[model samples]
Target: MGNAYYKLNKIAESIYYYEKALLLAPNDQEIKTNLSYAQNMTWTL
Candidate 1:
């Protein structure tokens, strides 16, 4: 769900929901991937 948003270029909202998801599933791989990608987006900007 959240991953879709990031891939759609909705960075701020994606990061918001990703942060929420991380709190619930710290070991989630998809979340990690999204986070890594989002962080890279941050660095790029």
Candidate 2:
């Protein structure tokens, strides 16, 4: 899962999973939020 990858500090994997999840539930706020968080992490890196 995205959250699991995020917690493990695997940003790319997290983003990948989150994007896949978004495809299934495009309007999901939680997935959007998590994806945003993962993306922001990339920016910080």
Question: Scored by CA lDDT, what does every candidate get?
Answer: 0.82, 0.96
- Per-residue alpha-carbon lDDT of candidate 1 for residues 1-45, written as tens digits (9 for 90 to 100): 567888788877788888889999999998988887886797676
Candidate 2 deviant stretches above 4 angstroms: none
lDDT of 2 by residue, 1-45 (tens): 999999999999999999999999999999999999889999989
Q: Give lDDT: candidate 2, residue 23.
A: 98
lDDT comparing candidate 2 with the true structure: 0.96
TM-scores vs. true structure, each candidate: 0.70, 0.94
TM for candidate 2 is 0.94
* RMSD per model, one decimal: 1.5, 0.5
